[model samples]
Target: MSLGDEHDGASAGGGGTGQTRTRLPDSGAGDVYGVYGGARRPARNSRSLITVVGVVVLLIAAIAFANRSGDGDGDGSSSDAPAGRAAAPTAATGVKPVAGKNGTIPSGYAHDEQGAQSAAANYAVALGSDGMFRQDSRHAIVRAVHDPAVVDGLLGRLDTAYSGAFLKNVGLNEDGSAPDGLTFVSRTVPVGTKVTEQTGDAATVEVWCTGLVGLAGEGSTKPVTETWFTLTQKLKWTGNDWKIESSSQKEGPTPVNGDNRASTADEIAGAVAGYGGFTYAR
Candidate 1:
């Protein structure tokens, strides 16, 4: 079947939809606080501060306990290990591919939950990268990550989604061009991943992601907005590899960050142009 046909099937049976869903605002480029006026900073209170501190301590302790508990089933392979212990490379040593392969695609995933997490994380990075700004590159990315059955339909819809108007709304000029002397960047960095459910051949992986999306140009209206999103992929082990059967994204499990210095356009542009993406592995 074509990509759109597959999307229809997945949507029909509610197969693609999962427990976690992304709540994206309809106005993709507008600020959520704009409708309600600018966001008001909450006033500080000593009592409130103390309560927050206490909660933080409890959270930390809970995290520590979860890590120590190793709640997930531990097979000989490291992929099924719990998130707490499976997070670090050392703990996840057995699951890491012998070496990165498939050009930029990480290979040798351990055919387990950890492997699904690794795939989901890397896929999120690929899906949200600046490469999606260009039509040709975007097609390549979707084909590479999506199951073969859905490639054509996804390509068509994505072509519409990344049309001239959408590009302009994303602060790009017509034909996906950036304003002179500026760069447009969109990338998702995975904060963590969890296997909500998994069987041998089918698995559901949710990647909690922090993304930066906007144009890095002087006088730009949207200057590098940050967002948190969770991407859940229903994966199938096909042809000796884990391929995305279907996936969806939703708003966040977000935490506010303290104020920090913003970088210059030059810095952001240089970093993006100079650096390259890694071949992620389990």
Candidate 2:
């Protein structure tokens, strides 16, 4: 529920900036085509971005606003293509084979557009993870994923804010560990990513993610639940890796809730422990 408070660096100071699932009511048999009505309308508009994003590990709708891909304002032109056929916006275009490793997280990204994107996706998982709840792990993660220039600034602020009342509020001990028989669930699964803006030295990337947060186990009041979010990270190419300069998040373009039954607490805990998470950037 509370993965703690937001760290958006606006009032705290500056710099912050989806892949998103779209839910359309099942039109049953009444669905119509090309009439701007029915569940199929968005299907026509978002095919290019949605398909590409799902494969690349992003819903990338966050940047669609810039290119006006589906917005009916275009003269019906795609760059370097014939008129009347809208081209895929360049921002949603991405590179593949994320080649890098950094301990638990991926590091050593190339100094290019693809590398910047990979960096942003991986960082989103780390920032939203259970590791951020613990002081030691949080410190290491902050140092590992952040730009060296801003690391101290973030630590100085985050370290103070992440302690005491917050942990207890989330049902964790003051030291950041869960109580006996309970497991804290805080994992971010990236659905899609987009390179909103890129340059030789810096990049702004958005990662669309679905997360599970809460306590899983018997007699727990905070049951595990799902949330959808988008994380925008500003990355700098430094030390041969793309490191985060600043990041922020917002609630998502959530999909309709599914019909699947909720799992029991023990079942959730077992599944979480038995299953390993993904290396999202690649």
Candidate 3:
């Protein structure tokens, strides 16, 4: 996520972060694709709607192309050529998954396409977590997942991005905590991952995720809400592992919302407390 000056602004500012309007999904609808943080300007105009549709179409096409199976290639290696089409992005590369961690972030990712994809997914979860709002946790996460060259700059920018005012806007105290008798909920669950581009030394991967942000409690104005976005990370092999070189986010390849009742704040809090985050792998 690009870090913007404004709290609602995802990571960075400018043309890519999206608009500044808020629209609650119809609880009756199916999976809601939401852009978390900042104000997202709703696409009321025809041109804006068209642009969103175009983006959705392109993203879907890219994902489909990435996931397509090889054409009777005996070996399912990702490096294998698939005739006229693009290489299958998520095809297994027969590499071992990393089995280690540096602090909370997974370490030792395989130095291949699968490893890159895996690194992207796990990093997505960390970057989107509530921990990112806390100074210590944010530093650990940045050090764990980001390339050494950019870590210092990223930490400085992020520290400013999640400043006191921003935290207040999102219903947290100055130190990224709920006042009392409330639970702060900011989590990202990656549904799946794709390697949009790859090489021996670098890769660009997209992680489709559903996230929970906001607070949960009695009379909480910023009630926990879910968001949908595809986080694209440009990763490089560094110190024998995949580390984030750069990252950006965009609103969804979101599916149509389904008919499901929205959970109450208490129920949401309970469920969150009962669950644990996963260590994702390709």
Candidate 4:
């Protein structure tokens, strides 16, 4: 499900310059809310800058202390951090993982914490993909990623979520295809995942991700835009593997604006075509 885009100068860098960001129309049901991208700003006065720097230093110190003091006792309490405190696992767990896919989506994950985290990450990619706009692919993805009992309910809800109006708003045809000569863009890139709770049969995971959604065509009105979100999925061990029992999403643990220059539409399309996505594993 990887459709890579090359970005010029995109980074969560030190700020103080003006930035231009594209605002997309709302494209789906209430689940997918409109989000504003970070814009550049003018530098602040010296006194204000000093205050900001002081606050940032204190925040960084607080976060470091929290992580070190986190309840690593394996009792699974106090696992979910407050907003802005959840950090990505800095190192790989080196655990053996799922060996195959149920279809295009990964399946057969190990029945443990790392497996649950990996399942949640990959499911975020599948559920937030352009494939969800099409019936066949959407059904396959839901079946592959979600618990069987909830598939029908989710499909119907998702059908309404990605309505014709939503498709049109995002620069797709009624059938969810890009018009001739245009390439639609919808991708989710997970930054990392955390398991908030776990048991022998179930786990709760949060995936922090950055995404791109819109159309990549020369004259497209809904040009590709980026979004930040955290997806929380409740997973259950089912059919000898992990499946999503329920899911919800929220806006972000969005990082500060990066100073990288945005790539052109043509560059985006070319990069997506040139680079393929991965079947993510942890």
lDDT of 1 by residue, 1-282 (tens): 011112333332111211111111233643211000111223333356677788789999988987776544453333353445444322354444536454455654667766767777777677666666677776676666667776776566555545566556556786777888677766667787777777788887777777666667667665565667666788888767677877765556767553345678767767778986554623
Model 2 lDDT per residue over 1-282, tens place: 112123334222111211111121232312110001112111123347666657455435556555564344322111231323323333323444445556678777757655666678777677667776676777777787888887666665555555466556566798879999999887777777767767668887777777777779999877777767677777888887888776656567578664346789999999889987766544
Where does candidate 3 have its weakest 10-residue lDDT segment? 13-22
Worst 10 residues of 4 by lDDT: 11-20
- Pairs with steric clashes in candidate 2: 18-60, 19-59, 19-60, 57-192, 58-192, 58-193, 59-192, 78-87, 101-107
Instruction: State every prediction's TM-score relative to the real structure.
Output: 0.70, 0.68, 0.72, 0.71
Q: Candidate 3 at residue 19, lDDT?
A: 12
Q: What is the Å distance of residue 203 in model 1 from its true position?
A: 0.4
Model 4 clash pairs? 2-277, 9-260, 10-260, 11-258, 18-40, 19-40
For candidate 4, the per-residue lDDT at 221 reads 68
Residue 175 lDDT (model 4):
90
Greater lDDT among 2 and 3 belongs to 3
Q: Over the stretch 232-274, how does candidate 3's per-residue lDDT look in tens digits?
A: 7778898998887766666777665433456888998898789
Model 4 per-residue lDDT tens digits across residues 1-282: 121110112121000010012234443322232122222233433456677788889999987986786535342223343345445452234454567878878777767776788888887777666676686777787778877876665555555545677556556788989998778877778888888777678898877888777778688766777777676777889999888776555566776654346778899899888987766735
lDDT of 1 at 248: 61
Candidate 2 segments whose C-alpha is farther than 4 A from its true place: 1-100
Query: How would the candidate models be sorted by TM-score, starting from the highest?
Result: 3, 4, 1, 2
Give candidate 3's error at residue 248 in angstroms.
0.8
- Once superposed on the true structure, which residue ranges of model 3 sit more than 4 Å away at CA? 1-35, 38-96
List per-prediction Cα lDDT, in the order shown: 0.57, 0.59, 0.62, 0.61
Better of 1 and 4 by TM-score: 4
How far does residue 192 in candidate 1 sit from its true spot (Å)?
Answer: 0.6
- Cα misplacement distance, residue 224 of candidate 1 (Å): 1.0
List ranges where model 1 is wrong by over 4 Å. 1-91, 98-100
Model 3, position 237: C-alpha lDDT score: 90
